[model samples]
Target: MIEERGRVLSVEPGAVWVETVRSSTCGNCAAKAGCGQELLQRLGSGGSRGFVRALTDRQWQVGDEVVIGVPEDALVRGALWVYMMPLLALFVVALSAQALGGSEPQVILAALAGLAFGFVLVRWHALRASRDPRLTPQVMGAAGFSGVPLTNL
Candidate 1:
């Protein structure tokens, strides 16, 4: 599980909205001085907060500190779906068009069309995956606790 500490922002039935600060390891990195990402991070607003609605069985109050988590496999699957599918679609369609003796402009248009189709498929998959509990983040436990699940609190 990938976990992060967050503060409860609001509560609804079976769910809590939590806000977590975005953090980076730049401060501890040995190559920070030579990294472009470190420079960009310095230029950008540091530690911006992101809000997420995490599923939970227990009631939580606003301002309560908690830990939230999602499974690592879910993240890997999501990354593949979001990145690989479009590129595969583009290549397959473009190559098919070329094999069929399509003109350069036609092959380019076909590749673009394939890429758009891939995005549409990804959107559909996301909508479906949003309802899958395995893909959703959950409130793991209250912050500062050790090895205790939130349901016990």
Candidate 2:
């Protein structure tokens, strides 16, 4: 499980919206310049806060601290879909165009088209996955009550 500590922003019947700070280890790393996330952080708003709607049965109030987790496999699958799929599409299309004796410009255009299609596919997959309960993060427990069960709260 990948876990992070967050503070509750709001509460509903069976879920809570928690805001977590995006913590990074970039400051200690040597390859900060080569990392895309580091570049995005520098160019973007750099607002470290992120929100998660975590499912939980326990009663929680705004400002409460809690722990949230998602399965590791979920992260791995998501990465593959978001990265590998587009690269694979580009290579396949480029190779196919070359083998078919397409002109240089035609092959380049085909590769770009393939890349765009891959992004569209990814967007569709994301929309469908948004409704999958298995991919949703869950509240592990309230923070600072390691010895107590949440059910007793």
Candidate 3:
């Protein structure tokens, strides 16, 4: 399970709205000094808040800290859907355009079009996935406040 710490914003009948900060484990790496992620982290340190709708059977209150967990496989699948689809679409469309004897410039244009189309398809699929209960993250349990703080809410 991939776990994250978040603060409960509100509690509903079957779920809680949690506000989490954006953080990456790469922040603790010795090589983070030279990592692009570290640079982006520094750049994003203005502290943005992201909200999660976590399904849970436990009671929660405002300001209560919690640990939410999602399956690692789900995250991997989501990452592939968001990143790989456009790349594969570009290559496939470009090759198909070439097979049809399109000019070099036309092939490039076709690839660009394919990339855009893939993004649209991914966006629609993401919307559908968000409504699927099985895909949503779940509240694992309360978290202690003694851990290292990444960012403040």
Best by TM-score: 1
* Cand. 1 Cα-lDDT: 0.89
Candidate 1 lDDT by residue in tens digits, 31-134: 99998778878888556778999999898999898999999999999999999988888889999999999999999999998899889889999999999988
lDDT of 2: 0.85
Quantify all predictions' global Cα lDDT against the true fold.
0.89, 0.85, 0.88
Query: What TM-score would you give candidate 3 relative to the actual structure?
Result: 0.85
Model 2, range 17-124, lDDT digits (tens) per residue? 998877566777899989976777777645468989999989998988899999999999999999988888888998899999999999999999889888888898
| Residue 100 local lDDT, model 1 | 100
C-alpha lDDT of residue 39 in model 3: 75
Error of 1 at 125 (Å): 0.8
Clashing pairs in 1: none
The candidate 2 region of ten consecutive residues with least summed lDDT is 144-153
Task: State, as a TM-score between 0 and 1, how close model 1 is to the true structure.
Answer: 0.88
Q: Could you say which candidate leads in lDDT?
A: 1
TM-score for each prediction?
0.88, 0.82, 0.85
lDDT (Cα, 0-100) at 102 in candidate 3 = 100
